[model samples]
Target: MDPRISKQRTALVLDQPFFGVLALRLKVVEDASCKTFWTDGESLGYNPAYLGGLNDLETRGVLAHEVLHVANGHCWRQGDRDPKLWNDACDYAINPIVLEAGMLLPKGVLVDTRFKGKSAEEIYGILAQEKRQKEKQQKQQGKGKQDGSKPDAQSWQQSASQPKQQPDSTPGGSSAPQSSNANGANTPSANPEPTATPDAAPSCGEVRQYTGDDKALKEADWKVAVLQAAKAAKMRGALPGALEAMATDAVEPVVDWRPILHRFAQESSPTDYSFAMPNRRYLHMGLYLPSLNEPAVGDAVFVRDSSGSVWDETQAQFAAEIIAVNAGVQPRRLIVMDCNTRVTQVQIFERGDAVELDLLPVRGGGGTSFVEPFERLEKEGIRPAFLVYLTDMDGPFPDEAPDYPVLWASTTPLKRARKAPFGEMVEVIC
Candidate 1:
């Protein structure tokens, strides 16, 4: 029996929480391209002879490591970063989490305590800084000429382009059953196993049996699979904290606007005494004195574009968000402004008042200028806790940012295509 298959079976037998069996479904491809073992966050690819040296636990650990790469959405998160450094960061992030699960990894796997609890994005920043420092030191030492040419950093695309192989040809060969005979019975044959045609593509359902690539997992199916896996691991009380965090992040993905709105409203709220509502405690004493209310959100301003690009329904949606934000903090006042090249209509509504858009006038149709709203606020002597601007972001921005936090809710399909000089951006997907 092949040691690779034997050890893999042994590893499965020793599964702490069934990670071995769960991860084994990834297409195991045998190729000499990888020196030891590597995954493109989709499939596990290795040189069979290299992995054959690992013990049963070590082999199982390696399998879990590859599966985790896909489970945690590492491939999808690698946007525009140096691939080698990204890979290193990802390894640093994952290796310790698996090792902590009482699994054994082969020696020389990257593991660093400093990167613990940090997301891959954070680790990538750290690695990028180190790479920059190394480059600077090399320049000071005159390692290269002042010419334009420089040694290239690691490329993610290069690694992503590696050819995938069938499980039968993987590092140690497949443990799957052999082909069925013409009589429809499984049988051993002296002939070589037939290989899939190079140009052949796997069907949708077949993708699960192949590499756990991002394309295969993108259709909201992975969420269901990952949630089930996480639930099983939790039941065994063997899920590592790091893996748990990643699983929670995948299962209940957070939207950008949620936290941004909460923080902005909370931080900008104010406190004051109100004569209208006396303290209930003091009311028992028959005193009609003013009561101190907990700090509530201060005045907040929201600006919208009344241009041809923005529709009434979009304006209504934006108004609803403002209403919600106001309700959350109970702001003293909520000001809504409509503008294009200049301020067209300005309406002020108290916390309990309804915003009637039909009653307010809509102005500006020639061109869009984001500077108009800020100027109008300053001219009207109206100060706000924070400002939120809703637009398609197709206008010229002010030369300088105002002295308040601004949240730009864009209706654009691509959020990254435009940027505000200051403040955060939230995409309106609806």
Candidate 2:
């Protein structure tokens, strides 16, 4: 009834050195009658029946494999790949490393000699090529249907190692032919159109994830948790070189646009006073009024570079990014301005108000010039904390940089060749 509890006890009793700490970090849940063990970035789902036969070492090894899955972000990295193949490729890359680290995988666990030392990505490519070849052969024989698109690259590593183990669907709706060394867990087939999970935190390697079921694992920002756990493991001399090398990328992952925008808003030094926040000193004297000092909020200005290149889709995505970033900063007001040859339209909203561009009117579809927007701001005597210019950096610049900070968010391929005369540059990858 409590197989996960038993596994934890085993990890503590037989392998307290490393697994003890790792077990504590992972959220382990029990599924009494499942065919395999699995993890969904947030929690490790275990089937007691599948694990009952393994000894303590083997059990610990299985547990480690699941942890490695979450740590390595295999769950999130499956980007547009076949789930079965992605998992297999991940196992191929991780299993050998696990065995080398002294843990023991159960017998019959998939371990290919050819994929030795290759990354999941490299292996996935090989597997994908094999799948393509097989698909081509099947088509020639008139035994299969073509989807018009190429076989998924993510399937590359999975099928390369095991071309014959086609996933057979079980009556229970789960796919059969379990992912190689996916600890024999039963996984659902890949979605025809696999997209990243919305609101799913960037796989930060964190230990917290809310699975909704209180009995399940809690939610967290994985990026922070993974980095912290790795650091802690290293400090305790428990982190393996293999794991360290894998975690290095997550520790210093790409600079996210949200943080960049939030920081831009945060850098503002607001001096406005609000009667809502009365001075305590004056309140004691029976006088409640707006404080002369201590501003609780600031304004954010978004300058839209509405050139022909900035398509509708790109514009909407940029607006969403602005809303998300502004939500984090909790600014007092938001002003959206459109500029192509010049500032064409301006819409103002309060902090919590929704800025829906579709409902509002937008002006401008002319040649681009970065000079007009700043010039308009100066002419209008509007000094926002900072200005976020959403553009492709394809226009003439102002003679001098503005007094306030500016964030040049571009979507052009020639980013490096183009230059912003001043202000930080953030690539807006929509």
Candidate 3:
């Protein structure tokens, strides 16, 4: 069994109060393999990731969450994933549990910080900031009653210098939210900038995704070499040498695999059952940010600097590029990085469903270091044919963008930088 995934299929059935019940077969999987529904049976499938890690508490929590999904009939929800319906379901099912479990959350559940536009830490920071802002307003209002005028931003900031209070909850079936004093708890919430424009911490980046499984690429060097050579030629405005390199015997070898596959499968299928056909399709996963209305092909990379903050811009622009392979195109692949200019992770987005843009890590709101994207694009083996970014262009970037043809689109006004890189620049309302 793969280290990242081991599962036991359950035989349990469904009932009225619990949408379904399941039998247990224990399996072990890698930290990474938790992405899919590793456990499946007649009634429903469960994602072990929900359990985060397999401690007793997490195991129970995951089991409970899955039970909730079954009970709510989320498995049978007719339509696809959309923000509204999904959020509503989470409110009904997830919130109550989280509120009740406030302090003793399972260790692994929240570890993988990937959300729509903010990192786990960044999102938490947003919560902290809101709390402080509210407290400031309360004190300012109290002073205003003694004098005359009302509280303002400055008064609120002054009040923020003081200590703060905290809320508590108990974990039974559901913890009833206690009504606290409005003088401190409510305080009119500082009017909140009209329609409560969200103070987004931000989310960012799509890892470089290759089209084929790693093993397939290893067995198909010639095909992949040809593809890479073509891209190099286009990028450098020269083709003859690259073409010659592609035609070489070693790096571009084409070996038939009929015998090799028979050796591996051990028991061959009946000749009549063996049938196949082939065509060309491709996909590239880049920076997938909700801030943009388009697609992306930029890898999420960390940068080098004093602060060591991972940069994830939701709005970036790309021109002169687009889809050219399946997310699992055997020949292409995605790369990843962290904030300290070190690579933290690299996973291929082979399956269509694996390409998640709304996860917290990529869109986590933070100052993005810009030098990494170009360095990634210029790497020797990469063959991505297009690029796009959704960014506000608010921070530092590399001295030069990659020479490969590119497109630059910014979702927000060029806030702090001259402009982002690309051949074409289009301003978007989103």
Which candidate tops TM-score? 1
Q: Which ten residues in a row have the lowest lDDT in candidate 3?
A: 201-210
Which regions in candidate 2 have their CA more than 4 angstroms from the true location? 1-18, 113-118, 141-220, 254-430
- For candidate 3, report its TM-score: 0.25
* Residue 190 in model 2: lDDT: 39
Residue-pair clashes per prediction, in order, are: 4, 23, 55
Q: Candidate 2, which ten residues in sequence have the lowest lDDT sum?
A: 169-178
Error (Å) of candidate 3 at residue 343 is 7.1
Higher lDDT: candidate 2 or 3? 2
lDDT, candidate 2, 296-354, per-residue tens: 56667888865444544457667777777666666677778877666667777786565
lDDT of 3 by residue, 135-242 (tens): 677886788776666456556787698654211111111111111123212121233231222222110100111223453443253234335444543455543432
- Residue 151 in model 3: lDDT: 53
User: How far off is residue 397 in model 2, in Å?
Assistant: 35
Which residue segments of model 3 deviate by more than 4 Å?
A: 1-331, 334-347, 351-360, 363-366, 377-380, 414-417
Clashing pairs in 1: 30-170, 48-171, 269-297, 270-296
RMSD of 2: 15.3
